[model samples]
Target: MSIKNITVLGSGIMGHGIAQVSAMAGYKVVLRDIEQKFLDKAMEKVKWSLQKFAEKNKISKEEVDIFYNNITPLVDLQTAIGSADLIIEAVPEDFDLKKKVYQELNSLAEKNIIFASNTSTLPITELSKLTDRPDKFIGVHFFNPPQLMKLVEVIPGIGTDSKVTEEVTNYINKINKRPVICKKDVSGFIVNRVFIPMVHEALYSMERDNVSMEVIDSAVKYKLEFPMGIFELADYTGLDVVYKASYEMNLRDKAVLLLHPRIKQLYDSHDLGQKTGKGFYEYKGDNYERIDLTPEKASKYDPYSIIGVATNNASWLIDNEVCTIEDLNIALKLGMGLKMDIFDFFKKNGPDNIMNKLLELESKYGSFYHPNQYLYSIK
Candidate 1:
């Protein structure tokens, strides 16, 4: 079936951008929020986004005007979905608010309407049970600043109909976004599941005295060429938000962000990163010079960077039938933008040579250095 009428909930950044994109893609879009002020803010966000596209010559200014004309800002949810073929909810992470929105949609939207959530961590399958038509429920998880990021994790729950899944996937791709299908539901889905833990591990690496923040950040940027060092990214992305999301995922353990088990205890004592001006490294004065950095001050934790490396060893999971080698490499390159020099050469050196390097790494780092059991067991 063709999707022509679209409705998006929540007038936050994600909701507004989703509405703008659908409108640009030639669908009538209704953007709804609980209040007029929120809707007004969301409309301004959408207009500015379209203007940026015009400035870059990606689309004409006239096109932005047309896109604005196609968007209808409504404060009423029921009226917003008057002719919706798909309704994507991009509300806050509060579970109660999401549940209430779904309940409202359940009584109002037509039987064929598809409901999707832009939740970063909540389970789509569990949330589907709140609707009368579970068959129409799906997850269209967009990365932040959706207009720029190209990928969308399309998660279909146990109750989701296969036809609906295919239709929505096609619709997302039509608007020029890559849709990576995830089987069933898992905490943080796939992207966040893998990415967040890596960030935590890097923090621990510095906390345990195995590496200094400057050194770790330097090694990643200069030697490994990661887009951003782990600790630096935490500051840039807001350590407080990451800390909250981690605690939410890990059962209120504050140590995960601190990279030490006592992090929460310390954070509660006003040791939270950047946001508090203290965190892992103390920001002294107005220029943000790091003041408190020493093995004694920050390195009292454990060294677990090897675990992070081991997790990235493609052979470990692939050879064991956990995931295909192709998907593993794609996840690293496409998702994380990582390209290990050893892995790059290993492709040309073949399996034996790759196995040998893993051996060397294991000898230097620890057991995490070894490839998955399948690699060692190979004849």
Candidate 2:
């Protein structure tokens, strides 16, 4: 069955965006929060975003009214979810809080209604277990700013039915988003599985090599042609968000991937990137001026070392059957907006060179930098 009505739980950053996208796609969407103030703020943001779209001709001026009308804001949970064909929970990333929400949703929601969480790094299997309908529960992780980001990671828990997976994938497509299936539910899924470690390695490089944040950011942005440097994106995404995601993933792997202490220091100080007006680099409003860091200083730290560690982690994911090579690439390209073929770089650099660099990093950082079996098999 097609999803006609979608209920977006929570009216925070992700929730509001998800609701807007669903409404824009012509689905009747209920944007629910616990408080009227939060609902009002979400609505205001949606209106401003819709107006921006209209000015850009992304949506017609007349269409703005149609889209806005499609979204209904409510504080009452039962009233909001009563007719929902699908409910996407965009709540805060707290285990107890999510479990409690699902427990209550189990009683309030219809038996057949599909439940999806927009969790970044949490296990779908664990979240599914909290509800009565494990087979119907799945993860529909939309990248930040769901209205613009094209990719959605559709993940199925161990108990999730294949049909439920197919339905959720179809619904994501209907909303004009590309769906990359995470065949197995693992912490960090696919995009963050590869992306987060890369950023963490960047931080480690800065710490070990004694390079400035600007040096690392400039090299990654200029040399690698990424849209934003590591620190720049971290600030844009909020250091606290990244730290929390890393901390959650660390819980499963005995802390193999640890956030740099500098990141934790920034997070603790509430200097959370663009949101808080400061992070790794200072920002003037939404604009961050590049400080003209020297590429010579950046060259002191090998870019390939960081790239190899991320690639090895990607290979590890492949080795474990978390996702196929094709799925992982698509998730990174579409979800993280890498916009380049990750595997092609391996072909260009050659496995021996990549492996050698990884080995060098491994000597300094231990097994976390060690190449996975897939890297070994790559000849």
Candidate 3:
């Protein structure tokens, strides 16, 4: 089905950006929120973002006006989604709240309208069960800043129609974004599955090896060539978000994913990273100035220890047929903003060396670090 009219529910950070992008792609977008004030705020943000794009020469001033004008904000759900051909839900990450929204939409929306969730952690398959049109329901996991982030993870639930998946992927491309198809609707999908585990390992390294966060952050930034250190990224992403994502993934796969104690403590204390000015580190000023990580400190910890865990998790995704190696590599590079392919370590170090590293990590970190069968097969 060709989607011409899009309805973006929630009109918050992700929702507003999704609406703006869809409008930029020449789709009529209805941005909906429960309150008029939220709709007003969302429109202001959308205008500001579009103006920035214009100032940066990314888009013409007239194009910004056109894009900004293309979005219609509304508070009433029935009026907002009445003419929508596709609905993308970007509500807060509450399971019950999302289910409630779907229940309401199921009754109000036409059966033919495709429903997509911007959920970062919850399984698409489980969410599809909440609606009558499971075949039309899919997950379009957009990164935090939808306006800037290029990668979009297209996840089709087990019962989702292949045709629907293709249509959504094509729609994503039309908006000038990269779409990596995730074959299975597992918790955390591709990027987070690989990322969260790597962060957990970093925390474990700090706790077990007694290494400082600065050393770990320095090693990750300089050694791994990541734009930001693991802790830095976590803080930037908000510790509450990280903690909740870890909690959700753990609930689904407790054996392999565990929430680290430090994450929980920071979250409980409400020191949620850059937004709150404190998390793994402290942030000061309105712009949230970056924490300086010294390059010399990179030598203190071996980054391969963390890379080994990421490699094992990526291998697990491949072995389980969750996503192709090509897609996984693209997802990491685009979604997680990795400077290199996730399996570059496995390829450079060879499977045997990686296995030995995993074995060593497993002995120190428990069964979670144990290598998947794919690594052995390659060996």
Candidate 2, residues 1-379: lDDT per residue as tens digits?
6689999999998999999999989999999999999999999999999999999999999999999999999999999999999999999999999999999998899898999999998999999999999999999999888888999999999999899999889988988999988888877888888777777878877877778778787777665656777778777778878888888888886434646677678878999888788887777756656556666745655467666766777787888888878888888787666657676656555667778877887787677777788877764
For candidate 3, write residues 1-379 as lDDT tens digits: 8899999999889999999999999999999999999999999999999999999999999998899989999999999999998999999999999999999998899989999999999999999999999999999999979999999999999999999999999999999999999998887899999888777778887877799999999988887778899999888888888888899999998754646788889989999999998888888887967777888898877666677787888888999899988999899988777878766656654566667877987787689878888877766
- C-alpha displacement of 348 in model 2, angstroms? 3.4
The numbered model that scores best in TM-score is 3
Candidate 1 vs 3: which has more TM-score = 3
lDDT for position 71 in model 3: 95
TM agreement with the true structure for every prediction = 0.77, 0.94, 0.96
Better of 1 and 3 by lDDT: 3
Residue 198 local lDDT, model 2: 73
Candidate 2 Cα deviation (angstroms), residue 227: 1.8
Worst-scoring 10-residue span by lDDT in model 3: 345-354
What is the Å distance of residue 62 in model 2 from its true position? 1.3
lDDT (tens digit, per residue) of candidate 1 on 298-339? 334322342334344434344434334555455445555566
Question: Against the hidden true structure, what lDDT does model 2 obtain?
Answer: 0.83
